[model samples]
Target: MNDVFITKAFTYLPNEPVSNDEMETYLGYINGAPSKAKAIILRNNKITTRYYALDKEGNPTHTNAQIAANAVKGLFDDKFRKEDMELLSVGTSSPDQIQPSHASMIHGELDMNKSLAINTASGLCNSGMNALNYGFLSVKAGVHKNAVCVGSERMSAWMTADKFNHEAENLALLEERPIIAFKREFLRWMLSDGAGAFLLEGQPREDEVSLKVEFIDFYSYAHEIEACMYAGTEKQEDGSLKSWADYPSDEWLKQSIFALKQDTKILDKYILVKGAESLRTSFDKHNLDPDTVDHVLAHVSSGYFKEGLKEEFANVGLDFPWEKWFYNLSEVGNIGAGSIFIALEQLMNSGRLKKGEKVLLCVPESGRFSYSCALLTVC
Candidate 1:
């Protein structure tokens, strides 16, 4: 059967790296003295440095569209052109605007005159894989000859001094809700800014090397778990969704600005129990065996989650190859949906993959407890 192949991959990380110490200085005093949340989170996550789309004054330096467009342009060479792409799939947790759509913005930025531009949102960290899945299906069905899939995030823009100050002001309320508070603070420190793009083609030349997409399977356990991480509208007591305009007070408006709410408690449980179960089922459905796996590329946000993931793998009786595992959390933090692709790029650049070798890409998104796993083979 003809398969979709990733012909090219590229990633863009804006600006210089920000160390944990620098983040502390930027965050400054929350209540009194220096804020310890950043320090504690950095220490616990084992993240030393992460790139941000921020200037020296801790302001947004670039928009999400710019970052994603940079990555996509990087994939272009003499053999490829913007018009050659039949589909442009963009995924992001942070979008430039809600109306034009991130994909459309990138399309405009790249000046691509033709292509189906699609934006997959609210998939959180798994959104990138979701975008790739769409491109893969489109190409596999002969609907498109070539496509571009990108995941980008400007998380630094969402995390500002004002947001930290707001959290400080509501410290008491947050303290009363430990789980919510943890999620808020953790995400603030965990998320970083970056973008990754892959050029997918329906066929590859005999001499060209490519990462062939074998199969992709997605499973959602949101029904069994509460909303652990989310943004946008909130449900009202009457079971109707509350519109942004419905908020009549300054306090409500303040809380609604790119609001990201999470229940750390449920997130923890979902990662350990439900997440593992879903992954095992996906593996079974795809006939992915641990022994045949050559590399494992995962998007784990923190050391805490990494430990939980290890436990989950063991629980499912999957022998994880620690030596073959690749991750970039320590250097790049978590770029949400971009993490897995970034790691995959790193693996490809490592020159370890050989023809017929299989690699597994695991992306667990907490937006609504969805997990995406893809099995790819080197060609």
Candidate 2:
């Protein structure tokens, strides 16, 4: 049983930061018109600037693997060599291709000299943590001297107007249903492109403050719950999901079957409730106290949930003052699987952490209602 430590943290956000008004320019207009749901969604999510891997023509400037590979590149310096890495694990909501695994694609982009072990964890936000947890275990078990774990998203490609134009047109002809139309465009305004990577080593860095991996645990309620957020499938009237393969290829365009979606009612209802339960259970199992935490990094899809989440935590005795919280979503948007690591990078760069302090990371996934939390101690 060896101990694991995070020696380095780095992030790569592609291109210039696109402001609220500039999103449509790069993403293009749906149905030859600006998104009517844009302003309202922006107001609720409160994201001011976000990154995209697309050029002005809505063509991809970087693949999902490229961004993750770039983040991995940032982890190396004069003291480190790419070949020294024993493992590479990447997590993402979107992959460059569905055939090859995302990690294999990222590994292909890197300049590593020898064969590298790679793992891909795909899902919603927890995918990154799953990758991290895999890296953590590999390092802890002495199987790997060092591992690079990444969480990234190339959401812009899927969010672009052309992807949903046909469905938007069909809906307009069927009826005057703004709510359903808004649902289709909702994720477009909420997600962006970014990658965050952490270098896990068996020993702590002596020159700089290292984050000691205390524990990484996940709680899932998939058996007791149905999907709240998802893609590649449509929720049937009976609340069952119908896979894309089950539908004809032509029908995929008519309904935009691959669009990222959520049952907002379920998200708003169970996210906090289930998240609190997940936190409380993990805390009790680990014998942790909320008051003992120095900094809390929470990955939430919207800023609208920040305060409400605090209230929920308070109900479960995990209350902490607002000042101890750290998040960077307003400036970066929600980068899905990469969010928690991105927040950690920003918090560490803020120079606020003191040696021996504790940083708790909370990542909740509405895709089937799961939660992941990690405890890190500044060393």
Candidate 3:
């Protein structure tokens, strides 16, 4: 098999940085005071600033396709052209629409002639890694000379002004109690908008520097746990799938929004345990030793998971090098599927990695509890 090398990687974050305090303003007030939801999200998520694709009036500034097209365009140069791309693999949690597919929309936006465009709907956080995995395999197998994998999300569009306004009113009606009802609302503050893309090549030139993909592995523990994160659709009493269009107009309006629903109880229960197990499995299968990995690039949703993840690593008989670990969740919140790539881009530019050094990229997705890890070497 041919080696797959990542020749270029780029990330695009729209608009200005929205601080946690600004997010509190977006949540508005409850009972003439700021909503407690803001406090909960700020305390739990540990995100200081995040970018949202919003205009001055707090309206969506860009579509998902636009965000993706911009990221792909950033990766283009005289050597890599849109027409030279043989495959376009896009992974997205919040697609513009279900039908035309995000990849097709991006192709149209780029005005590319002809290429295999595919959209992988692999939950929220894992979608980017899944898209990269596909592109890596395609290039490795010589199926495509050049492929671009992108993960773009416009989560701000899902939390419309109307939803926040309605949620504030609903919070006012409820009696003082625990804030578990605001899980979905909390996620709105945690998620932001961004796109990341990587250009993969089947063959490498001696004069150029690249990140070589050694191995990529994915593991899932969905069967062992209930749904911890989900968006869109719900099951009916008759064992049939009820889509958004199947519901009443009012019901559809209430449930059809693209916001994600999370059960923190399940997240707390399995995120660390399942994540560590999956990482260990990937390491064992690929023969990746922790002592040899020079740096670790991780896409953890919050800083709160850092110690727990370390403990899990210890449980699996691996010593996690905290000094060599890097993450961007505090600066960018969680961009879902785009998180890992964004983290990778930032780490590569930090001047910490040396040539020929091995780096491990860890991605843990809460949606149905999945994990993907990729081993790469700096060239």
Candidate 4:
């Protein structure tokens, strides 16, 4: 088996950065009334600026595939060519079309010089690590000499006012809460539009340090918990979800089936607690010591979770210094699966890393309650 290394990391945040005050200008107000949830959610998230692939008039300026391809394009140069890549893996919670796979669309958007194995991993946040895991194992198994893994979300389109206007208008017809719950609505304020990609190969970069891939680990508590975040579905009274296909096409619009939803009750109850447990379990599984980590990069939805997660991790004796933590959420907002990759891009270029230092990567997904972790060594 060949060892894998991340030779390059790059990100594409579409358009210019939109400030907190400018968000409603792009996403607009649901039901023509300003969201009561937006200000409160923003206060907790601490996201001052974010990128959207949409214009101020709510028209999308870039497709999900286009942004993904753009991130991939940044990874190529004299050393690596489009025609040389053996695999292209893309992960996202949002895809432009439901018929063709996200990877297939991105492949078409890339318009590479030759055909390659294109894979799409789907989910909310964990999809990024899942995509990375696939490429890591493929290279480790010698199935490919190199692979490009991307995590992207073109979520502005889903957060638009028109998408949720039906639910706001038809609230009286539903068994669920008549008013859109904070859980059902806050994602419009939380998600951003962006794409980030990592280039993996059997050999490390010779000119500068590369991230030696050690391991990628993920855990899901779906059996004990129902979905915490979802789209294209509605939660039932029994905590089960009804698929979008089960409902009539018109009913889809009425219930906002395509709009993203979160069960805040479930999120508050399980996300941090399970994340700490998973982190400890994964650390033990890998036989790693927390003190060895020089930097910690994570996919965080809100600034609120940072201290909460620190407290939970402290409970397990994994309290690394707060200075060891680095997050770009305040600058870029949460890009879902792309969050970690964007964070990695900044860290990789920040000149903070020194040779032989270890970095820890973490991502927690509230959708179905999952956690992913990985270790990389600067070499």
Worst 10 residues of 4 by lDDT: 172-181
- After TM-score superposition, the amount by which residue 277's alpha carbon in candidate 1 deviates from its true location, in angstroms, is 1.2
- Which lDDT values do the candidates have, in the order given? 0.77, 0.90, 0.78, 0.90
Candidate 2 structure, TM-score to reference = 0.97
Q: List the residue pairs that clash in candidate 1.
A: none
Candidate 3 lDDT over 1-379, as tens digits, reads 9989888888999988888778645433333455666776678778899888876456677898999899999988988877788888888888888777778888888876676646565568888888999999888988878789998898887765555444445444564332324656667667888999999997654555578999998888867776677766554444234556666655543443345677787789999888889888887887767888888887888778888888888899767668878878889888988888888877766667678888888888887788988999888
User: Number of clashes in every candidate structure?
Assistant: 0, 0, 0, 0
Q: How well does each candidate superpose onto the true structure, as a TM-score?
A: 0.90, 0.97, 0.90, 0.97
For model 2, what is the alpha-carbon lDDT of residue 147? Answer: 94
Runs of candidate 2 with Cα error greater than 4 angstroms are 172-180
Q: Is candidate 1 or candidate 4 better by lDDT?
A: 4
Worst 10 residues of 3 by lDDT: 24-33
Kindly give the stretch of ten consecutive residues in candidate 2 with the minimal lDDT sum: 175-184
Put down candidate 2 lDDT per residue, 38-110, tens digits, no spaces.
Answer: 8988998989999999998999999999999999999998656887888998899898888699999999899
Question: Would you give me the overall lDDT of model 1?
Answer: 0.77
* lDDT at residue 333 of model 4 (Cα atoms): 92
